[model samples]
Every structure is written in structure tokens, then in C-alpha cells.
Target: MKRPAGMSNQALEFIRTASTKASWQEKIILLEFVSGLRMPDIVASEFDLSPVMKNEYTRLLIERDSGKPIDLIIGKKPFLDFEVNIEDGVFIPRPETEELVENTLIRLPKDPQIIVEIGTGTGVISLALARKFKDARIFSTDISSRAVALAKRNAEHLGLSDAINFFEADLIHFSGSEILKGKVNLLISNPPYIPSSRIPHLDDEVRLYDPPLALDGMDDGCSVVRRILDLSIDYLSPDGLVSLEIDGLIEKPLNSYLSQSTLEFKKGVDIRGNLRFLYASLHENSFSIQ
Candidate 1:
């Protein structure tokens, strides 16, 4: 491939060599390195005009060639309008999860008094909610201590430390559960929904880098989801809502389970048109389905 006008020979040569062994979005990754911009901004800017820090850019190229995700290589990821600090072993938030947050925002009550988030990996969902509902007392929990710590830091960095309460616990098992029971206005999560058997088939960057605790959903992938649903019965308010990001393959079984439960359920597709989001509310206060 002919080198773009302003790209250095070193960068061009590295891309040429790495292309033989690995497949990546070369242009986007390179733009991120040179311009210090997130993917969305990188796409709009002229890459050739962006100044590249040669040594750091070379190091990033080497890391990318070794199959590390660019987010990890850079140690940060953009979610919504803010960037969150990420660490090794914590599950990186995906674009789909951002969509989950936006959809939840639309369906949530105009002014929720209390909100609970299960499996708050990176705390992006809770952070967004705290920003949107400034007065809402938001409780976010994650089983991984590292994730909880990192999430707390992210909150502090965004000046949201006072708005969210981060804790280390599995699902809704935190010490403050008594305070949340029957009072949670909204409960949301992008929990681990990938089946155990499918983990090996995931991309190398995801399977090798992301922690298993954030990926495995056990035998059928609905274990965590089921637990969350059961817990919601006790935790959710009379008019509360439950929104979750789920794997499309388990829709039928989950649908069957929801049918038997007291919550009125609805499912929606992601940007790709796959059924990926599930929303439920107590039958007494059904969703104003849009």
C-alpha cells in the first residue's frame, strides 16, 4: 500500500509488516496513536496532519501486533462523552453497553429517587445515570474488587464521587441491600451473558485479555440474568424498571422465564438488529413502551 503523504516511513513499514500476521482496523488504530483522539473523533480528522510521538507510537504498534486491544494499550476508553481510566484484568465496556445506557435513560422515570446497578464493570452505566439524574442515589456493585476500585477512580476523575456509591459484591449482595429493597426506581446491568462453551470462540483480544469473571455466564449463560431477575422482585419499587443487556441466543428460554414472573417484559434489538436488550417492570407499573 502506498504511504499516506504525511505518515512516516517507520509507521508505514510497521503497518506493512504487521498486516501479514494480524488483521486490525489499521487506519483507525494509527489515527488514535498519532492524533490522541478516540475512534469517533479520529474518523472525522485528517490523520496526515496529526503529529505522531514516534517512540510511543512505535510501542503501541508493537502491542497491537501482539493482539492487545487498543483500549488497553492506551489505558483509557471513551464511553458517552467522557473517558474512563481502564486497567488490565477489568472488562472493557463495549459500544453495545453504551447503547444499553442510552435506552435505559429514555425508559427510566423522570426523576428516580434511588437506582441500583448490578455487575457495574468500569462503572460506566452508573456514571452516566448519576450524571443524568444528579439527585438520584446510585448504588453500583461488582464482584471484582479491582473493577470496583477502578470504577471509583473513574467516578472521582469525572467529579462524580459524591453522586455514586461503589461497592464490591456479587449482584445485589452488598451490605446496603436493606436500604435498596423495594425502593429501587431502576435496576440496570450489562451482565456476563456469554455462555461458558462460547468463550473460546471469542476474539483473541477479548478471550485472552478480559477477566473470566466478567465474561462467563456459566452453562447456559442465563445464570446471572436469572439471579438478577429474582433479586429484582425484592429490590424493585412498585413502579421500578429492570433493563439488561443479553445474548440473543438465549431469548426463548429467558422469555419463557419472564412469562412466569410477575414483571411485564419487553425485548429490543441492538444496532445490528439482533435481540440484545431486555426490559421489565412490575405488572402494576408497566413500561410506556416506545
Candidate 2:
């Protein structure tokens, strides 16, 4: 949707200037990009200057002038056609992750597929995929119970509870296999792939506000990716597909690794030209279970 008119550019500029020395203004912009929340809300509830009784507008101006990440202040983010609940416990969903759903939808077969999404997060990916593939039975899992509940809430709020099954599992480590093993026609994942060392270098909003588990990927940063690939082989149907979202920087290494696998895999780029998706097929030409 187009941004609402009458949002004072002057106010935004003031906030920008206020946070000049810090990265808070950039954080606000990023939040706006991700959540679609306006400057009014940012200044109103985020910094809590609107109802302060005295010097309200002045305080709002001062806070904007002081600089603070809007997500830190506003406390939520929107993603993939839905307003996903966000907290320090969860990683805010990104635009590139949406590409994983878009590309997977493009390659889906005519019949139903038992789709499983690993690391469901705020359940944005699963919800987006479920919305697109309405007939597909979606089972979404995450390690965090809070995230699981949040996902469930989002699904029910979107009237998608009947279409999805929510589970709390540690990246396929839980008893999820009882219902998920060898049953998933398609396995989709957006695993944590960021390197441990790089975590400190990320933007303040991400480093400070997003969950660490959602970003850290061990020494070489492929720990979660490798685990997903290794564990998924048995879960996939004979000709079922596995789609993954990975860091573009590791595309070369991942591609080289996938080349040696029995499964055939291909990469897809997102809107920003990032190699955001990895599509793998167990066998060519058929999506049916064998």
C-alpha cells in the first residue's frame, strides 16, 4: 500500500537529525521498510512522547532528534503480507526471505504436497507459503515455544489454523519426526546461516533486538544449513523438493557442496539480485510420491 499522505516530512527529518550520531534513524527507516508503520506511530507509542502531558510535540521532536531504533521502540515488525510479532527472542523477517516463498510457489506441482517449514520463526514463511498454496497441508516448527505460540496466533488470526499444524521442535531434533518423517513432499527452510564472528558487526537493531540463535551459524556459518541438508534427505518424498534460503555470500560454497549430493539443486535470486533460494529436487520430471 502507498504510504499515507500528510506524514510530516519535517517530522521525519527532525527524527533523522536527532539520531544523527547514532544508527537509530536508519533503524527507524528499516522498521518502516519492514513493518509499514508510519512516523506518527514511531513517535507516538515508540518513544512515548505523544501523551507525556507537557512538551509533547517538543519531546517527540527531541526523541526523534536523539535517535532510537523504531523496532526497539515500537516492538514489532510486519512481513510477507502479514504483521508478524517480533521481539528480542525472534529475528525480524526480511524481504529476501519472501523470495523463498515466491520461488517455491513457482515450482509447486498441481497436487497437494505435505509441506514442512523448519525454523518457522514468527511463522511468516509458513504463513506466506500457506496463503499461496491454500490446499497444501503445512506443518511449521520452531525451537522456541514462544515463537511456536506466536506462529499459532498469526495462523489463527489469519484464519489459517485449519490449514497449518504448529509444532515446537529444535530444527528437526524433537519428536516431530513421528508426524513429519518421510511424509513431507516438500521441506522449506530459512535456517540461521550468519557466521558467529559477523554477529558483532551487524546493525544495532539486529544485533541488539533480534534473537541471536536466529542469526548465529557456528564457526563457518553453515552449521544450521548443513544440518538441514543432512537431516532433510530422509524426510523428502522420492521426487519431492527441498527449498532453502541461504546467505548470498556463501552461495558458491553451498553450490559446490550441493554438486556432490545425489539430489539435483538449483539457485534462485531475489528481487535485490541476492542468491536467496536453493531449490533441490530428489528426482526430475515428477512431483508425485513413490
Candidate 3:
């Protein structure tokens, strides 16, 4: 195959060899490695291709062949308009999660004062919220110390450190919960919602590289969702909204569970039209687990 003009010989060779094992999208991973250009920039032809060191090109191919995700290989992933540093064991933010952020934004009250985010893996959701709601005080928690530290670093990088408080705690169990209780305007999460039994069936990119702590949702996949709902009863203001990213397959079971709560619930689909997000607001009636 003739090398596309402006493409370096090394890049062409990398694509040819890497294409053997990689899908067309995976083949695009070479642009990230060689030019540091994201898919959008590449699609627009806005970047100049440069020669990659032979040794580095060979090393990247080895990593790619080993089934390492390109985001991990590059040490960062794009979220919305910014990039967040990531490493192995941290859940990489997904396009669906970006949709989750947008969905939450439309539902938020103007001048939302307090926001709480659970399972802030790379802090992308909280960071995006902080950027949008400059006056809102946001608190985010992650069970992994590494995740918390990385998120703090991302916040510092984006000059949003003051807007968000990063905590190394399980969902909503951090030190600031006392102050946030009954005052939060929005409580949002993209918690683990995949059934424990399905973990092994996930793609190797997910099952092997992503942390189980961020994926496994215990039995029937609503364990964390249920916990978040139960805990929201204490933290959410009477008008506070709860937004979550959930498995599309669990809508029936989740609605059954939500039926027992005092929250008024609505569900939305992703761009693919799968039920993927849940939005809820507390009612005047008291919450109960039943």
C-alpha cells in the first residue's frame, strides 16, 4: 500500500504491522503515539506527522501487541475539552461518562451550590463540573489512594484544586459529609454497575487493565447503586438531584429497586439509545429501603 502523503515512513510501517492485530480504530492509536494528536485533530488533518524514533516505535508496538490500552500507553486520556493523567488500575473515563456529565448539566439548578461526586476515578466528572459551575463547591471521593492522588494532580493541573475537595474514601464517606448533608444540590456518580459474574466476560481491555473495584457491582449489578441511593437520603437536600451512569440491562431491576425509595426517577439513553443514565430528585416524603 502506498504511504499516505505527509506520513512518515515509520508511521506507515507502524500502521501496516499494527493493523495485523488492531482494528481500524486501534490502528489510529499510532497517531496518538507518534504525533500526540487526538482523534479529532487527526480527523481534521490538523497535525503534521513526524518521524518516530525506531526504538520508540518498536517499543510502542510491543506494548500494543501485549494488549495495553493506548490511553495507558500514552499515560493520559482526553475527557471533554481537557486531558486527564491516568495509569493502570484507574478506571479510564468513557465517552458515555461524558454524556453523563452533559445530562447532569442540563438538569442542574442555576447557581447549584454544593455538588458531591462518588467514585471519582480520574476525577473527570467532578473536574468537568467544577469547570462549568465555578461557584459550586464540589467534593469527590475514591476508594483508591492512587486515584485520589492522581485526581488531585489533575485538579491542580487545571487550576481547579480549590473548587473540588478530593477524598480517599468509599462512596460519600469522607470527612466533609457532615457539612454537605442536606445541602447538596447535586449528587452524581458513575459507580460500578456491572454484575460480578460478568466481569470475566468483559473485553480484555476492560477485565485485564481496568480495576475490578471500579467495575464489579456485586450480585445483580445494583449493589453500589442501591448503596448510593440509600446514602443519598441523608446527604441530598429536599430538592437535590441524583445522577448516575448505570448498566442499560439493569433498568428493570433498578426501577424495581428505585420504586421503594422516595426519589422521583427518570431514565435517559446514551447516543446509542440504550438506557444508560438515571436522574432522581428527592420527594418531601422520607426515604426508606423497604
Candidate 4:
């Protein structure tokens, strides 16, 4: 048996066969992962997979073949300017949500006293706000205690723990103090908006790995969105804005909701140019949707 660094090819063939569906290149990726060594570091070097490394390589390949998201496999996802660790059952951040944050930043007040984010998975939106408005009181809420705890950890890691507050609430029936009602200068959310019907059709990587709590939005995919809009009617301060990340399927219905509201309506597009966000402000004047 030919050997490089005392590793037998016949032994390598067993690892390859054990991977089931992973290709040769994928095996190399898995090898590099457990080796903690990049391709540049491994080139022309005496490379041998340690026992622990070999075990981990096989484990990761098995998980990968079983449809786990690559980001979750690595346990980290990059959003905007920083990488956030992913916990089991927490939704990984997506690029569309980053576009939502960018749009919100553009529309925010110069110095908002209070900002509230609903369904703040992993604190991505809130963390961005904390960095943008250093003095602002940022309030983030999630229905899942586990998600809230994980998000808090991410905030603390970024040194924004003292700058932001995280809370767990079932918003549908939440009964908090008036501080959030009519006092919030800005309200933002990337609520669950994927229609229940569409969930089964989602890619296995998402349907099988991402938390349903962060994806399902009932029948039309705007049930939670409607609730948020109702809350904003009373919660948003005068002249304040309500910004949301929405499914493309909800645009027409959302437009109708915005048209009836006392707040002025503004639409935004994501990086791919899809109508992915809706902005509303307390106003009487009319403006065309852009």
C-alpha cells in the first residue's frame, strides 16, 4: 500500500466509502476542517490525519450528508460586519435580512431614544443598531427563551451587552408597560413570513435544519406581520417608523394594509431587487412607493 506520512490509501478508501454521498473534493474539505489546516498550509507538507481528526472528519461528513446546513456544520455565520455563532434550533442569518438592516439604517432618526426589534433571532438586527446608535436604548424580543439566551451571548461577545436589552415574549398577547407603547422611536422586525404551505417545499438544508419558529407564518405568510402592524398602530411614537422584512408573496396584501393605515407607506428592495421590505411612518401626507 502506498503511504504518505504513514497514512495508508486503503485506509483512506474506507473513509471515502463511509462518507456515503460526499465526493472526493468534499472529503478533502472535511479533512481540512478537522485538520485545522488550510490548503496552503497542507501543500507539499508531511500530512497525516490524527486519530481524533479522522473521527471528526467522518462525523462531519455524516452530518453534512444528512442535510445539515453548512453554516451550522461550522457553527458560525457571517452577517454584515461580524460572524455570529449558531446554536441548535436558532435561525442562521441571511443576506436578505442584512439588506433589511441596511434599509432600516437609512430611514432611522439621527438619534433615536428607543428602538425595538421583534423576533430578533441571534440579535443580528439589534447588534447592528447598537453599534450604529451607541447611546440609543435598544430593546430586542423573541418568543423563544433559548433563542433569547443565545442572542444575548452574541451581544455580550460583541461588547454590546450593556447597550441592548433582550426579552422573551409571546407578542400576540404581550402586556408590557407603556414604555413600548407609543414610546419607541423605531420598530423593526424580520418576522417569520414563509407560508406554511411553502415550508414543506423548502430546501432540505433549511426545512430540516432551520428552526420552524423562525420560518412559519401561518396561511398567507403574514399572520405575524399583521399582529406587528396592529401593535405598531398603538406602539409606534408619532412620526416614528415601522420597518419590516417581508416575503415577496405578502407585498400586495401588505400594500393594502399600509394603504389603510394612518402611517405613510414606503417600499424597499433587497440586493437582488426583490420587494422585500415595507416601511411605514405616522403621517397624513401621501408619497409614491419607490
Candidate 5:
């Protein structure tokens, strides 16, 4: 739909600059993204927005001018079969990661004992696992304290507080793997896999607003993958499988890491059909092909 008559291109440009470039519904969509308030409710309400809501909206507009993701302002993001709260500075789950989760879910054992998820941002994977495997115990960890708290709240609200445990620790350094030990039947993660040099070139919402701790994967983007693979060696059950999200560009390097490990892997394609997941299980033979 074209802009209304007499509305100068400059005015339309300003609106487009502030939000998306939708033709007719941009304004309404912007309202939905920022506040999650229905158009009818907002139009009919006689009560005023709470002082907190007013301040949040003001800050949201300022953030928008600078290109923060609207999901950050809306305080939530929908992930495979669920909605996860996304607080400021916490990483929002991307649609591409859903492919990783789906592939893992399909491979899960019907009566698995324990599952461990590293870098459990917003508990999207762990919570999803809980819903699928009600008898399985899940343990999830994140280096960010804020992410841990938010994930915990999400689990509680979903009535999964007892089924999942949230931990504040980095998988790269955590050594208490003996708690689950060799009983962990599955390991999963969507860790930082963005090459460090490429991070600065990402969109402002990703480079500026998405937490750096969750996006920077060091020089080659396989640093976290390497560390987590070593971590899984100690925690996985004999038949345990590990699944991870990775950058398609680093497939060779990532496969190299798999070559040195004792795990056999099957690659996965993402929503865009690019190979972006590595699902592996223990292989008795050492030094497999890259």
C-alpha cells in the first residue's frame, strides 16, 4: 500500500527509519512488538498504562532509534512450541536454532535418564526437552546470571521447576560433571559460533544489543565448540548423543574437532537449508575423518 496522499516521502522515510518498512501495518505491528497489547485493548482501555509500562515504552522508543531488536523491547521471543522471556542484553533465540532443537528432539531416547544443555539461554532447549521427556531430568547452564534467573522463571511458569535445574556456570570451566557423570544420555547447545572478526559486521541489533558473551566465538568461531566437546567427553553416557548449532562457514574446522574426538556425527540443515548442526555419538574408533 502506498503512503496516504500529501504524506511526503520524508515523513514516510522517518517512519521507516524508526521501525520496519511495512506498507500499511507497520504502525500496528510496531505497537504489538513494543508492548504486546492488543489494538482493541489499547483503543478501548480507560485506565492508563502503568508508570512502569510508560517508562519501558519510552526507553523502547529510544532503543528503537538506535536499532535494538523489538523482541528485546517486547521482553519475549517465541521459540519452537514455546515463548521465552528475553530481557535486555540476553540473547534471543533465533529461528535457525530451532532446526538444531528439532533434530535433537527427534533423536532423543524414549526413556533417557538425564540431559545436559550448555549455554541454556532462556532455557528454550531445556524447557522444550522437559515437555517432551517428562521422566528425564534436565540440567542447564549459562555463564550469565541474568540468563539463569530468567530461565528459572520461565521453567517455573511452565510448571517445570522440578524437572529442570538452572546453573550459573561456564561449560568451558565447569568440572562438577560427576553429578550426572556418565548418566547423561544427551548433551545439547546453541553456543556462540560467530567468528570474532565477523561480529562487528553484524546488524546493530546483533552486534550492539545481543549479549557479546553469547555471540563471540573467538577467532575461528569454533573455540566454544572445541571446549564443549571436551566437556561432553566426561559427562556423556556410553550411548549418549551430543547436538550443537554451528556456523556453516566453519564446517571444515568444526569437523576437524570431531575428527580428533571419539564421536561419529551426522550434519543437519537449517531453515535456510544450510548445514548448521553437528549431532554426534560415541564412536569406539579414534581419529575419524574430518
Candidate 6:
């Protein structure tokens, strides 16, 4: 069998200079991942794949040099505790977003709770929560149909189909009316918060590949978040908690919004010490959805 390409001195140099701004460990990881050639394969391909003609390896090098993100090139990203499949259509889950899932789980009632996640991009957050809280029934929604399918596939792949239900619709639109209505003990979302004007400034991988709706918020980057806050009063159980991921820069605006709401709320920072999540709950168990 013809051997696949090895990491050439040229390729190594190419990667080194290409990713020089990135740390040494990062560059090594990027090279290994982007080429899709394993260590042994890389060692063997040195002879056959060197001075490459037009092929996948050549394309990977070119793209890497051009600043295409390795995850997008490799078509997946490791998020939370799972390797999530990714494509150009969905939002790439970030480590900071994990804060929403972790904090929400910490605050959930120990007894069985109906937990619903809005805008479940890759099902990363919801799947992790379901695995962590085996006693909980988890339901998730996405405004993008492609995202919904992706989330369902992710759930099924992770053997979580029995524990997680998937739906397609805008945030709270489908959530407020159905088996999910007024019974949810917790609500979680990582809605898009990149203000429209600023979305264009995002990295090419994000601006060019990820779904715009998953990144671009309206003018203030709060359209979807504001809507979610509005519906939490009607959709969440009295004792239910709502946890949302937000841009740290908007802490003051978000705090002001929660101030006027009947629910009491708190914000928490991520591992990077950035304000990343909002936790809100009604004042009492008697606070029914009226």
C-alpha cells in the first residue's frame, strides 16, 4: 500500500513558521491534527508524501498557513468532556460556555428535575448535564434545524437519546407551550451575544464557517438573551433556575435587566475569570407561571 505523508522538515518548518505566533505545544498539536496523519503514518509518509503534489496534505498545509482554524479543518472540536462533531453550519462550542452547564448543574434540585436547554448547538452542554445528572430528564431546542439534527445525532451517539429530548424552534417559542411548559425546573442557554457590527471582526473560522445566527446578536448582542429572560417568568417552575451565558462586557446591562424582573439573579465568572453566566430564580415556590 502507498504510504501516507510524514511530517516533512519542510512541513515542520512550514507549520512552525505558519503557527509561530501560537505556542510550541499548540503548533505541534495543530500539525498533528490538521494533517489527519498519525505518528507512525507521519514517520512513513516522509518518503512518499514529501515534496507533495496536489493532494489533501498539500491543501492542509496551505490552509494552515492561511489561518484556517485546525478544528474547522479537522471538522471537530473537543468540548467539555466530549469530542463533538463540527461542521461549517453550527457554532463551535467554547470552553467558557461549559461554565453554564457546570453552574446550572450545581444549582439544580437533587431530586428529578425537568431541565431544558435552549440553543443547543452541538448538544455539548445538554449531553454533559444529562450524563452528570442521571436522575434528570433533559430536553433541548435549537432555532436552526441543522443544529437540531446535529444535537440529536450527538445525543444518540453519546448513548444519551433515552435521557435527552431534542426539538427545533426559536428560544422559548416552542418551550413555553408543550410538555415543557411551566414545568421546567431549570433553563440553560448560551445564546449568541456578539453584537452584529462586531461579528465581522470575529476570526475567519467563525465569521466564514459558523452559522451567523449562532454568533451574531442584534445591535446590542442581547436580542435573544432579552427574549429568553422575558419568557423565563412564564416557562420556568417557581423554584426553577435560569442560567445563561453572556458576554462579560455586558454585565451591567444584564444586571439591570434582571433587577426589574421578579426573579432574583446572580452572575458568575468562568475559569478565565470573565463574567460568563447568569443564574436566576423566582423568589418562592408559590411563584407560579400566571
Worst 10 residues of 1 by lDDT: 42-51
lDDT of each: 0.82, 0.70, 0.83, 0.79, 0.76, 0.74
Q: Report the lDDT tens digits of candidate 1 across residue range 35-68.
A: 6667655334443332345555556677777898
For lDDT, candidate 4 versus 6, the one ahead is 4
Clashing pairs in 6: 6-42, 6-45
lDDT of 5: 0.76
Which scores higher on TM-score, 1 or 6? 1
| Residue-wise C-alpha lDDT for candidate 2, range 1-290, written one tens digit per residue | 23224444544454455434446645455445434567677545433212232243344334434443455445556776677656547766777787777777667654447888899988888888788778888888898888888889878888888988888887766664666676677888888888888899987657876788888887777788877877777887776788888887676667667777777667777887777777776676633222
- Order candidates by TM-score, high to low: 3, 1, 4, 6, 5, 2
TM-score between model 2 and native: 0.76
Per-model TM-score, in order, reads 0.86, 0.76, 0.88, 0.84, 0.81, 0.81
Please state every model's RMSD to the true fold in angstroms.
3.8, 5.9, 4.3, 4.0, 5.5, 5.2
Position 219, candidate 6: lDDT:
81
* 1 versus 4: better TM-score goes to: 1
Model 2 residue 201 lDDT?
96
lDDT tens digits, residue span 1-290, model 5: 46434444544444455444233353545555545666565545442334565455455566656676667766778888888788886788888777777777676544467888999988899988899889988889999999899999999988899999788989834556577766778889999998889998999778888899999998889999888888777777877878899878788788777778866777778877788888777753311222
Q: Per-residue alpha-carbon lDDT of model 3 for 1-290, expressed as tens digits?
A: 77555565655665677545656566666556665667665545534444554456557767777888888987889999999999988999999999999878877655578999999999999999999989988999999998999999999999999999999999888775787788888899999999988999999889999999999998889999999988888888877888899977677679789888877777888999998988877763322211
TM-score quality measure for candidate 3: 0.88
lDDT of predicted model 1: 0.82
Score candidate 6 by lDDT: 0.74
Which should have the higher TM-score, number 2 or number 6? 6
Relative to the unseen true structure, what is the C-alpha lDDT of residue 187 in candidate 4, on a scale of 0 to 100?
Answer: 85
